[model samples]
Target: MRLIAGVDIGNSTTEVCIGEIDNLGNVTFPASASCPTTGTKGTVVNVHGIKSALKEAMAKIGKDVSDISLIRLNEAAPVIGDTAMETLTETVITDSSMIGHNPSTPAGAGQAVGKLIGFQNLGSARQNEPYILVVPARYSYEDIASVVNRINGMINIEGIILQADEAVLVYNRLDKKIPVIDEVKQIDKVPDGEIAAIEVALEGQGVRMLSNPYGIATLLNLDAEQTRKVTPIAKSLVGKRSAVVIKTPAGNVKENVLPAGEIYLSGEKDISVNLDEGAEKIMKTVADAGKINDITGQSGTNVGNMFERIKTGMSDLGTVEKSDIHITDILAVDTLAPVKISGALAGETCLEKAVGVAAMVKTHHLPMEKIAESLRQDLGTDVVVAGVEAIMAGLGAVTTPGTKLPLAILDMGGGSTDAAIINENGEISMVHQAGAGELVSMLIQTELGLEDRHMAEQIKRYPLAKVESLFHMRLENGQMTFVEDSIDPRFYGRVVLLSENGLIRMEKDIPMEKIVQVRRDAKRKVFVTNAFRALKTVAPDGNLKNVSNVVLVGGSAEDFEIPEMLLEEFANYRIVCGRGNIRGCEGPRNAVATGLVLSYVGEMK
Candidate 1:
């Protein structure tokens, strides 16, 4: 009797499977285990996670590490996923044309249009026209109301805009009922004599007029071309509870092109392409470059730092020469990055157009031999480095109950989307594409403006819910779930992470609907896009129609929606796609580990 342990180290997880080989060379596996990868795969640190997983598996069967006959560790690839999704695009703000941003609390109702004037000058303004009061934060509501009520007898005071949170107090104490907008931190920046429009919606609702391009055009009396130009401004102001728009001179709205810089693809002949043409054109150039020698970015630019970081990190690894690292694939998604407004009435952000690039670099050498030698010395057990990861995954996937060859396996793991096709003759053709689960998490973090990485990770792992009331909450799908006790006041009327530890408030000021949209859109961009990209490479004639079956197997495969998303995307080609079932019990895990044991048997042949 012999007990063999097959361990597979991944970008995000490490798994193990223990099997017993009989006298007839038949293997019966009884235990399997998994844990988070301790560190970068193929490094000395990974031995910790591998041993931890093996220990867990051994504990299941009441056995110790010494009972294991042999340990098989995977030959991990050199490339780690760089989840940088940054882009560059340009937009110029003409004067103080618009203020579009979220303010924690806003008060008032309806819209007001008036000639802006200094609050102190209200005493001297013409009584013939309506005027909007601009109250600075220095003055209390008592003084503001005292001045405003006294002026109402002289002129038609339409509405009030305050730089402090006294809207309700002033509105309640006033002799007249008018819309009030507060928290205008830059109240002094409002041009003294410019015509402006202010809109404040009722509680739980958002401003509509200023967010509409036509509404701004109508208020400013601008022509068609000018209205079209301010569309971005209106679009950015969409969910604000209140907004202010002012018009400036024609040239005030500047036009500047965002310089995303250029990339140099080193091949037989190095060719450079501007990143503004987007990832499609850049990748087409890379495809034409046979045997990518290297890739470099322009100096003193975002792309420059990205490439430099990858090179420096690879250099720090001390295994692969920095010069030998080649970019194998790139995925670019057009996205908007939020940038702070320089000076504005409310805390404002301009959505700048950017290209989020996820790049995969390939190295000429495999760094697994060093890891295997180190593991052997540390564990007091013989360790063998297996062949290519995709090949092992495909072999393991064949163990699925109803699997047969000429089949393609979509090994959707964090850091990389690997695909492998096993022909009828048992030959394997495989490739890896960058952008996976971690990339999805990066997108969620950036789009939602979350600085906490752990919060973003939790959002990626769990479904979101909005705490509508104390007793019940509505989930992302609009299903209502009831809790016996009232939710924490901080999470009330807010989107929350429904984690195992209870509800965690999403600190961002975005709504539940928007958060759900960002998360789903991100998953679609990474998984749906990479699925087609990965399958096209291994399928005959580079067509997805040729591949009949796709079994998803990886840490991400267990996701509630990813498999469904891939299935929907692959439905067009009539390909049968589903998550892999390894050993009929390990849903999408243990495939690579199970295959390692089978591959060791193959080596004996």
Candidate 2:
């Protein structure tokens, strides 16, 4: 018989499952064990911590490191999203330069004579001609409106050319029956008080007599060479996505293009994928695999970086060499806005900032080759990484098999909240966001001004029991315990941290009731709020009606009151909510690790 050991290294714990495979290809679970993960969820590798877990797990199955024949590892991906970029508008100070003109729609274009006011005086100014409004593209609609209103009385306002959306609104409000084109390519640098042409297409109305530069030349009685000048402005409006041509009676407009290039990633195989059409497809492909064991740079996540850091730490400590470390499997879901990045350069859209933020919110999984490898590396001997959605699906596969599409999974971990949606076709959508158990602990610490993070964590995790008078209490194991007579009333609701001598007390004489209230409130804000938000974000089409089953997983899911709290909040949707029954024994906490083993088996097949 061949034995396969599935290891899952998580952020908080390491879980190992030993299974035996026979010639028929059936796998049977033999033994399983769990221990605290060596390092911070995804950050460091503690060789000693991992060794302890491995020893304990192996001992359960009466097997040593050499009993396993093959090993698989998961890949890690880190991503960042939801970054805000603020740009200050209306902050340019420069000498008036350039001319810009836009006409909504023209009927046979012609040049009009005009003088530029703001920058026209720099050159020759024609006092006896109509003036055109030259607006820059960078200005906001309000700013453009203000400028137009300010020059309304002073200038003829023959046409209002602008850089922003104001042009459309301004043109709509024009009193005269003048032709207007919406978007003008370049308006800032039009020459002042010069003879220029504005062109407009006449669908069937033919060319307007006023639109013809020659007509203007006839009216002004200009020479043939001078009449040719307005032709350029008419030509500029052609083929533009949206353009407005104002027959500038006097000024000329010119257009120019800017230089830009795309950046690509260095030292790796480059792949180009269009984000607009490809994001959902790619996400679906990754999700449908039921389980993704290893994804290198292809998927970005917070856990990926955590595993890399642990690997580096292990190598530095001489516990394991870099080559010995192998990432067998990795599960990462993009919790970012739908922004795409191409090559190595910033995306033209808001994707750059999203990528930056996703990089900060990453997670990963790693598997050692053998028991000695784990012992030497000082990492979690048992490691499993799976998307929260996949875990929920596995649970649903066991509990409610013939359900509808798009089942939801709310994974309330210590550091962050994760939510995933699995559809009937096995397509999955997942999201990770800040605010979970750790956030609750932080709130408690801050509100109560406690210095011990451990104390805060304990307070957030367990129920409180106040020491009432010096009465004898029965322990869970039927042991009798007696408290001291001189205990403060503040310790009435607080649990006793038994020491070598006597019961411990908090530094501050804060009431236990207040602490319990604060703790509960913190959990409500961080976990409950985050769970709802994450669920809404991951559901297909942002509709909750599609999700009928929500399986809770992760350490936080084990909280006695948390599951009920979520059930109450999500009751409106007629959804069935409960913890995952991993292997029909372990609770939701082992879902990831168990799923990792199942994923490994599937990949081998």
TM-score of each: 0.84, 0.47
How accurate locally is residue 355 in candidate 1, as Cα lDDT from 0 to 100? 66
List, residue by residue over 373-425, the lDDT tens digit for candidate 1: 88788778888887777788888898888888888998888888888899999
Q: lDDT: which candidate is best?
A: 1
Instruction: Write the residue-wise lDDT of candidate 2 on 223-249 in tens digits.
Output: 766557544332322332222222233
Weakest lDDT window of 10 consecutive positions for candidate 1:
87-96
lDDT of all predictions: 0.79, 0.48
Q: What is candidate 1's TM-score against the reference? A: 0.84
The residue pairs found clashing in candidate 1 are 87-355, 94-252, 94-253
| Cα RMSD, model 2 | 20.8
RMSD of each: 4.1, 20.8
Candidate 2 segments exceeding 4 Å error: 41-48, 76-406, 472-507
